[model samples]
Target: MFNWNLIGSIILPNIGGWAGAITTAGQMKNENGTAWYQTLEKPSWNPPNWLFGPAWTVLYCGMGFASYLVWRDCGGFTKKSILPLVLYGGQLVLNWTWTPVFFRLHQIGLALIHIFLLDAAAAACTASFIAVNKNTAYFMVPYLAWLCFATTLNYSIWQLNKDDGENYK
Candidate 1:
């Protein structure tokens, strides 16, 4: 018998992650010739543009699997599961919103702030997951590490271009 619930639980976060990626990709297409993201002054340590999709794909899968573990351990949204799941959902929403704010709206500063909140929410989610399953919490560690890197990158971009009026461009 196929475990549909397990499959769905894993797919849910990937859907949200890919939806955001697709939406941001569409927005990038509207940039005519000079892509706004490429024009930004990123940090020297920033990864190449081509790397983001693959990196995000892996992160999303890990996060989705982590959520499934949590759900499985707590018996699918029982009272014991409520807090961690809510934290997970909240961080997911924050995760989805960051791309649009940074890429579409060109609000680098706002995106930095948003990512800070996401970092906190993800940390809380990981802690809650640890209570449910230590192995599940391990899955979130990479995502958390990536988020830290991303936050530093965002802050760097914001600082590097704060006076350039690139946010408006």
Candidate 2:
């Protein structure tokens, strides 16, 4: 059996993440590694711009796969499935919102808040996924780790730029 629903489950979250990236590409292109970001006071440890695309691609794939496992184990849309799915969806929305908040709106402080909430949501989603399947839960670990690192980066950016008064505000 092809299991089209299972296929959809595996594909949709990745697609959503990809689409979100595409939709925000213009802002990212404008802000990333450009004079604006370069002018900002950032930590020396901040990742090079080249790393983000590949890292996000892997993370998005993991998200989709993890969601698929939860969907498969819980047999879709039932009471057992709702919590994990909801948590997954919630974190996805938060994930999608971060780029725009940071890049487009140029709100580093708000972006830091969003990323922290995103980290919390992702952690909760992972825990819920564990109740359904351990492998699925494991799949989210790297994403969670990345979010933790990203949160630190975001916080550092906000702190470093807080006195810039003219740029961020």
Candidate 3:
């Protein structure tokens, strides 16, 4: 009656989300809320700094639920399950690293590249998940949309401040 598998589907993706969030928090130990990010020449369309936390929370939960659906449909991590899950895991790592790449290291150009790859990986993950469950693939749509916005933002910031150098710290 406890429904451990059901709990796992909810908990597992949140764990992945938390891992990325915690790693980003650690990486941004000295950067978050500091002038470093605030001082950037962001685009006019850039959302306020306060918006990111909530946005990511929703996105992460959706991601977890989607992954769970795929995992359940695929009958766990068999050979059939490997590709989609691996792609999901890979994109998650890239997702976590982008914040540090941009905020901690102040490497806008490199961060742009990372995000582009992240976008691709996420898209592939979604496509792969479709074979397992339509809902799983649908769940990734918002994340992919967010990534498109983020990619544009990153590129704009990079272009805007390319001459500023890495003096952001």
Candidate 4:
């Protein structure tokens, strides 16, 4: 008989990741700060505001499923499995942190720092996932690529808004 428990086990973690992304994304200021983002000196090829949600939704789902695969392939919460999970969680935490610091507090500089760390964590997580499960590792590759782009964008905003010092204070 097919292991229904195994199937559900793999599915649940991805669902949890999606749920968390949705719950936390609720804190973003996409509509509230459209003017603020528009005023910034974004790249020539920067995507329209409407693109971010869809892109991130897909990426987060990939990360979530990758996470589940990594866990399952590594025999679930064992020593080998733990590292990837930790890295996954670390990247997710950093991902979740960026929105609040940038949109809510208006701390672009701090948000840039957060994004940089997030990029590093994501790369490491991808590496670990690849070591454990090729399919899972493949899934996170796009997310890592996007974060690399995002880090550059974050740096750009910090550079353009260098004069934002103490303005919100």
Candidate 5:
């Protein structure tokens, strides 16, 4: 039989993982000259938007599982629990902030800065999680890879559309 309480404890954080991705996706919007992102000069390697959702979904689930393992391995709520949770939550919040800054506010340049910070936060968080649970750290590998791709994409976007200002305030 499965431990219902154990499963429940991790459920909220797992949902947060999903929520972070969905929140970002919800912020995307299209424009007249291009389909939101279609007008932007993406690198040749840019993956389609559809790929992002599924990828993030899987990654977040992995993250939740990793965190759960850490929580379980430790005394449920120790300094260890707080460490990974704080780091993970911090990065997740930063993750959620990127899309609004980029798409909603039309601030790709600012978003670039935000994404860079988000990347660093995730790295720091990953390292901290590793101290508590190696699997937790490993779960973030996909997130790290995606962030690297995103950093390039963000920089490219900022460069491609500089000075236009378009709808930007």
Candidate 6:
């Protein structure tokens, strides 16, 4: 028999993740040829722009599945499930917020701070997931690793362009 709840759980997070991506991409397009991101200095190790979509797709799916596992293990929104789900929800919001803060608002420093909070929230969420189901926590590992890498990249970008005060506008 099929588990529609599991499928729905997995699909919801992916929808949230992709919706943010689409919105941010639209905002980027509306820049009127300014291409502000291209003007910023990035670390040599920064991945090509083409990589982000695919990377985020995988990460979002993994996290969605992980959340479903946690939700299933705890038997829906009962008291036991509240903490982990709340942590997961908090981090997801932080995840969606970073792109606009960095790419649209051009607030790299603020984005860096936001990502640090995201890293902590994700780590806490993973730990909470482990308490419910250890195996499910594994699904979050790659996303956590990616968050670390992104934090480094955000920090590098901030350092490289902190002095370009006038260009931030």
Models 1 onward score TM values of 0.93, 0.87, 0.85, 0.77, 0.81, 0.90
lDDT rank order: 1, 6, 2, 3, 4, 5
TM-score comparison, 1 vs 3, better candidate: 1
Tens digits of lDDT, candidate 5, 1-169: 9976456645655565566555555445434434455556667777887787777667766666776776788778787578777887898788767766776566788888899999999998888778887777667788798899889988877776785667332
**What range of 10 consecutive residues in model 5 has the weakest lDDT sum?**
26-35
In candidate 5, stretches whose alpha carbon ends up further than 4 angstroms from where it belongs are 1-34, 167-169
Q: Determine which window of 10 residues in candidate 1 has minimal summed lDDT.
A: 26-35
Q: Which regions in candidate 6 have their CA more than 4 angstroms from the true location?
A: 26-34, 167-169
* Whole-model lDDT per candidate: 0.86, 0.82, 0.79, 0.73, 0.73, 0.84
TM-score of 6: 0.90
TM-score winner between 2 and 4, please give it: 2
Evaluated at residue 96, the lDDT of candidate 2 is: 82
Local error of candidate 1 at residue 123 (angstroms): 0.3
Q: Count residue pairs with overlapping backbones in model 3.
A: 0
What is the Å distance of residue 49 in model 2 from its true position? Answer: 0.9
- Point out where model 3 deviates above 4 Å: 12-34, 167-169
Please give the distance, in angstroms, between residue 123's alpha carbon in candidate 3 and its true position after superposition.
0.7
Distance from true position, residue 103, model 1, in Å?
A: 0.6
Q: How would you encode candidate 3's per-residue C-alpha lDDT over 21-133 as one tens digit per residue?
A: 65555433364555566667888998975687778878887887888888788888888889998998899888877877776677788999999999999999999988788
- Put the candidates in TM-score order, highest first: 1, 6, 2, 3, 5, 4
- For residues 1-169, write the lDDT of model 6, one tens digit per residue: 9888888877777776677687567544454764677677878998987798889888888888888888888988889999999999999888988888877687887898899999999999999998899887678999999999999998998888888995443
Query: Cα lDDT of model 5 overall?
Result: 0.73
**In candidate 1, what are the lDDT values of residues 21-137, reduced to their tens digit?**
886776445547657777777789999777988888888888888888989999998999999999999999999889988887889989988999999999999999989999986
lDDT (Cα, tens digit) per residue for candidate 2, span 55-143: 98788878888898888888878899999999999999999888878876778988988898999999999999988899985679999
